[model samples]
Target: MKRILPQPLMSLCLWLGWLLLAQSLAPGDLLLGAVLALALPLWTVRFWTEPARIRRPHLLLPYLAVLLWDITLANLIVARLILGPVRCLRPAFIRVPLDLDSDLAIVVLAHTLSLTPGTVSIHLSPDRRVLLIHALDVEDQADLVARIKQRYEQPLKEIFAC
Candidate 1:
């Protein structure tokens, strides 16, 4: 079973996602979804170096809520900065030190930063100890770094348990 379904949850999600996107209950669609659900994971499983293990699954919901709220607030702040004055913008590149050792955790942190408005993850150091971020407007670099560490990184560390 493990050999056949390397990632059972991922397979299920892909199958459901395919059915939802196709919007059909036809036998052909069902078969195709099943095939894709099975085949894709098999093909890509080698690329996954570490099996994703969520230590605190219960915290996922609250983490997502915080992420959504932050994104919304960031969107408003970015809009104001863009509409107000380019001269007032204090664009800067921030280096955020990582406490996460897991590759999956680091990737998630990077993606979350990129998803938020006004910030984009530019690079991850060769040792993966630091993540470089480009922000559209930064009033205090230290504050931004602290916020990112506390708001995003800490939650992820707990969830991924890295």
Candidate 2:
């Protein structure tokens, strides 16, 4: 069963999604959806890496709250910066050194930075030791790097244990 259905949940979701999009219960549609659901997961399973193990699952809620709060605050700050004089904008690209060794943790950090307004993650070093970010207004690059490390990276390191 495992060999035949490597990701049964994914397959089920795909089938349901297909039906939902098609909005049909026809036999042909059902057959097609089933075929797609099974085939897609089978084809993609080889590309899937090992799943990330959360070391501190309880911290997830707190992490999410912090992320949401930061997003809200960043939205207001970015709005102000955008509305203000163009000359006041100090856009800069800074490389944040990573203490995270896990690929999952690094990806999460990159996504978190991108999700927050005014900041965009540009590139990750080949060795995965650093992440390059572009910020809309950078008063102090060191401060921003430290804030990210403290607020986001450190928590992620603790949570993911990487």
Best by TM-score: 1
lDDT of model 2 at position 45: 79
Clashes by residue pair, model 2: none
Q: Which residue runs of candidate 1 sit more than 4 Å off their true CA positions?
A: 16-34, 85-87
lDDT, residue 87, candidate 1? 65
- Lowest summed lDDT across 10 adjacent residues in model 1 is found at 81-90
TM-score of each: 0.86, 0.75
Model 1 residue 81 CA deviation (Å) reads: 1.8
CA-only RMSD, every prediction: 2.3, 4.5
Per-residue lDDT of model 2, residues 35-139, tens digit only: 999999888878767545678979988999999999999999988777866666789999999999888889999999999999999999999999999999899
lDDT of each: 0.92, 0.92
Error of 2 at 122 (Å): 0.4
